[model samples]
Target: MAAILSKIKTEAEGTLRLLWKKIDPNDLKPGDHIYSHRRYGLYSHHGIYVGDGFVIHFIQTETKNNVLRLPKAEKFAHRPPCPKCLYDEYKDLGVVRTCLDCFCCHEEKLHSIRYFVYGAPRVGLLLKKSGTCTTLVSSRTANEVVEEAYELLRSQGFGEYNLCQNNCEHFATFCQTGKKLCTQMSFYHDLEEWVKRRIS
Candidate 1:
């Protein structure tokens, strides 16, 4: 019995060490901005990386806009809906706190980037405002910023999913700097300009 217990403890410790090695503990801090580019490279999504192998982000449920309902006599009428179809019908989307593993593992390949915010040691007492104005700047510790963002996510959630306005990047920027802005929009605009120049 003693030998078996010792082996189990050793295995558990080794497993934990391997898990921690995958994500460097020093690399991730509360309120750090993490983003990943979509497979097509046209857009990216952002999230807040809190400690303990977790990230907070907004998710929008995709409605089945083109669900086909064939006639009763159709050959496929007797076929059952797949598990994904059922999930799409019942899944709820919005601001959610999920494990980092789930966030990274997707069918579409993604490249992730992390951005660190300054003034993570000083605690400032000021409410973050939305938009481009940076008049009321305040410093906050990383933990404090993470707490405030988590509270907002738990209490208020978000308004709606707007690609141009309210998006994942906007949410993450707001969490770190108290300003809502989409960095990808500028990239897209620049790409559009480059295309126009090529055509002209």
Candidate 2:
């Protein structure tokens, strides 16, 4: 039992290294921004890693936007509350710190969402499919990112989690870059405008 429990966590890494390398949950450094595709790759849940296999993230308890849905039956699960984080404690959307296992849920893979692509690397990444990474660069150092995450966890200063105005990606990006960004949502908004223009 002990040996199995101590086994290497390879299943935690991404299977595809096409653009940004899939991150191993165990190898995550403090302040690393990571995410996992949920709801069949429709959207991802983002967070900031604070080492020790823990992650700080935002969650909107009643969000119905993302196309991600939970079966009604699981709402009445017989399981106990999570130990590492009283995950059940955050009944409302706010900053919360949880172990990576809880953060990623049952997902086998994770991605480092915030990355700097430059010069030749940018060329290769641009050639890949979208949603794989972002071109935004962070001016903040790792320590700075970690500091902000902890601060928000304590203050819940991020306000209510909104699927658009503010969200998980926004929270993690704010920690890592000291600014909020949600490119995917931005992409959708742009696409919506384009459709309207064509229809008009």
1-200 per-residue lDDT for model 1 (tens digits):
99977776665554334322334436887776666546644565678888777778766633323233435324332323223222222244566676664455344333444342222211110221121112234355678668867976777566677778788777777777777766467556766999999999
Name model 2 segments beyond 4 Å from true. 1-20, 61-75, 89-92, 106-132
Number of the predicted model whose lDDT against the real structure is largest = 2
- What are the models' TM-scores? 0.58, 0.72
lDDT of 2 at 194: 100
Write out the backbone clash pairs for model 2.
none
Leading candidate by TM-score: 2
Worst 10 residues of 1 by lDDT: 121-130
Please provide, for model 2 over 1-200, each residue's C-alpha lDDT reduced to its tens digit, 9 standing for 90 to 100. 76644332221122124335666555668867777767665777888888888888988745333324556644544445578776663243478888776777733343344322211234344343333455566778889999999999898899877889899888888887777888668867877999999999
